[model samples]
Target: MEYVFTLKYQLADEDRDHEQIVERLFEAGCDDATVGMGQPGRIALAFTRDAADAWSAIHSALQDARKAMPSARLVEAGPDFVGLTDVADLAGVTRQNMRKLMLAHASRFPLPVHEGSSSVWHLSDVLIWLSGRGSYPISAGLVDIAKATKQVNLAKEARQIEPRFNRQLVPLLA
Candidate 1:
């Protein structure tokens, strides 16, 4: 037999809410449960269980949920902007595929936005696009530009570091 168990936890400082977080866990086999607020900013939760074996099942579910949400604290901030990258992330698609999906479903979506001569899409518009033909649930939230910028910077730094190692190793090999 299987049972569900929920553990309440506090959110971290740099996190935001992720709406699809819970549903994804539930879909992954989290048993009957509910989550809410407790002291100050802490979270409270309830889980159901029919046997002791359910503990492992519950832990697996929680781990999956944590991976999806990452930060409990920010799970409530919601998405702000829907960039092409963000759309790709939510749809579990590649950038090229996302563009394909958009183009293939253009007639289904509302007219693309034209801002300063370039086409743009509102977050809501993307949600509509997902609703029309997507199999997964769409969550609302904006791309964290600051985080994205940092990632780009980190990638650039890594490329710079790679040459230093290669240059030093090339002498050793010769």
Candidate 2:
């Protein structure tokens, strides 16, 4: 299986030079990725890697990235965060249609991670829903990758949770 995913990071000052960073990443086994340095202090690696499973593909890429730039902070693992338009585009439907589906199936629709004027959902959630609905032509590989990315991203973010605070917070959250 070939998993396609993007890992975005906040680069440390030591990793400032674009050319050197690219070289280092390549030497560290991220040759499978296309590195993008579009924003200052940030780098994005888009990878299309072959592995037996989606988790292995993303896990290896993340490990390779760590070897290349140990100081870089992982910012996001995407296609994990998306809006209705993004889901619609992936499904080859209009944004309005996607919204209508959500509205029509409000009870079964996956909850958005963030709710605002611009709501965002984990792509795997929407893809799964569409697959259940049938006739969406959604790719199983993409859904698998999305699920793996979402899990990886959540685990990364979970590092920030203070165990004592969580012990207190978890009860309050309910």
Clash totals for all candidate models: 15, 0
Q: Tens-digit lDDT track for model 2 on 1-174? A: 788899999999988989998998999999999989889999999999999999899889999999999999999998799999999999999999999999999999999999999999999999998999999989999999999999988898789999999898889975
Tell me the tens digit of each residue's lDDT in model 1 across 1-174.
Answer: 444333555666443343454565466454365755545545544555343343344445455556644565222111323467677777777878887876787777645534444455544557655756747555322122222222333343456567779788768955
> Which segments of candidate 2 are over 4 A away from where they belong?
171-174
Instruction: List the candidate 1 regions with Cα displacement exceeding 4 Å.
Output: 1-80, 115-118, 140-174
Residue range with the least summed lDDT across 10 consecutive positions in model 2: 165-174
TM-scores for the candidates: 0.31, 0.95
Report every candidate's CA lDDT.
0.50, 0.93
The alpha-carbon RMSD values of the candidates against the true structure, listed in the order shown, are 18.0, 1.3
